[model samples]
Target: MSDLQFDSSSAGIGEICKAIICLEIAANMKHVLFDRQTAIRLSGMSEKAYIRSFNVMQNGIGVKNTLDIKELAIQFGCVRLIPLVRKGLSLYRERFIASLPPSRRASADFTRPVFTATGFYLCAKKHKLKVNKNKLIELSGTSEDEFSSVSTSMKDLCHDVFGVSTEKKDPKSVKVNRDLLDVLPEKRQAEDGGYSSDEGKDV
Candidate 1:
């Protein structure tokens, strides 16, 4: 038992230790991965219940951690740690797209049946290669005129949002960017052998 120093140094040292511990915990959590089924097993909740509870928590907090398990499940599919992996990939993709010149950006907007990032994602998933204006409108639950009004925006998303290439064949025809489309993981697998050879290879 030596003489104890009742100074700010002790308090500062304690705070530093706490900060180091918090960072370690955060780093570990960021690497944790679980699928929807695994998450259910861990949380001991049914699918519906988990969704409901997650929604409540999300609403209450009004802020979200990028590593929140439930949010990752919803945004990046049910694949383990895929959302975390995608977070990095998305940042790189966003930076690349944002770096492009305005002339190449092709920013446009649809009015009725309002277009969104999700909308573009859905459209890409639904239409494989190419689609006409009317076909896109039908898929989007919008009137033909509304789709026509926002056609430029839709076209812009081809490169800006979706990273897909586009070609205007004529006044009524726009070719979907299959070159960029093939880069999708699912499509790549399907094109290769209907399965990724490296599937289940842990990141």
Candidate 2:
């Protein structure tokens, strides 16, 4: 607690108390449903500060190398669709891990963010959410091309594993046929088969 740099004032003390209380409740109610924003609000601290404090506590408790998908969703502006993201991650965990190179598979230091970003992007598309592709790539700390490749692989995995079709259905098109014709004005003839006086003459 002392290592966590909280302000040494009355308000800071209050904030610390609120954070501890929220943490305690969360620890006790492991199965209770709650959102990340709700916990942050209950902690009476800014989102950044709350996350920092929470990470400190998490490390103190010997919990290491954890990735918070909820926080990632929040960063990607898809907090409401976290369930779908989680489902994708859960379903594709093994396949994704297996596809990685041996070095990366061993450490998995950079796998979480890549998978999280891919899951979030897929979920956003499935749910028809208007998420910015560039923003998601930026937040995931991945290049646009890399994100695109992962997204494509994840989409295929989704189809194979979950039977969810990720291909866009094109609208049916109808072909039309028409005959064009040109019409000419009728010409008049005289009784003797000669041209009329008015015929072929400028008015």
Candidate 3:
């Protein structure tokens, strides 16, 4: 055997097949865990592409009253990946609010809460609409007498845009949104379980 090249006979084929299967099963059972931040590295996409796409969607995509899911799906690579796109969006929104300097924190009034300022920023960013705080306040003409209603409106805004719970009395309460960062249901829900019109399955 030392003088000759050791070669596998036809009988060895069965053993080779078993080894390959064992490797694949082991890989499947391994804890292949990663977050959106690390998904691009783990997957086929390039690093440059992931960064560029993430930034454009977050800083540039307008939240104008319209929700465009197809456009988003294409940007993220596949329609099935909408859930992942939301992850990047959530981080962007959270970071934007967290960046505010001290003096800008919402005032004591609950209706005209200081976080309304952050909500305004989100509305502008999400809807592609430009809004100046002074203009909005002037438009609503928030008078002292209307504080209760204004505070209620502010609380609702807090829930929708920032996902932060307005019910909390704690000064240091964190802002968060319960839903994923996604387009309005109208634009997105209709596209669920997607197939093309060219290949219709529905009656």
Most TM-score-accurate candidate: 2
Question: What's the TM-score of every candidate structure?
Answer: 0.24, 0.40, 0.19
Which candidate wins on lDDT? 2
Q: Which parts of model 1 are misplaced by more than 4 Å?
A: 1-34, 64-118, 129-203
For 96-150, candidate 1 gives per-residue lDDT tens digits of 3454556644541112122322233334333342324343333333233333333
Encode model 2's per-residue lDDT on 89-156: one tens digit a residue. 77665554555556655543333344576677677777777677665544443344445555655665
- For candidate 1, the per-residue lDDT at 95 reads 42
Model 1 residue 63 lDDT? Answer: 23
Q: Roughly what TM-score does model 1 have, to 2 decimal places?
A: 0.24
> What are the runs in model 3 whose C-alpha is more than 4 Å off?
1-65, 74-77, 102-203
Instruction: Kindly indicate the candidate among 2 and 3 with the higher TM-score.
Output: 2
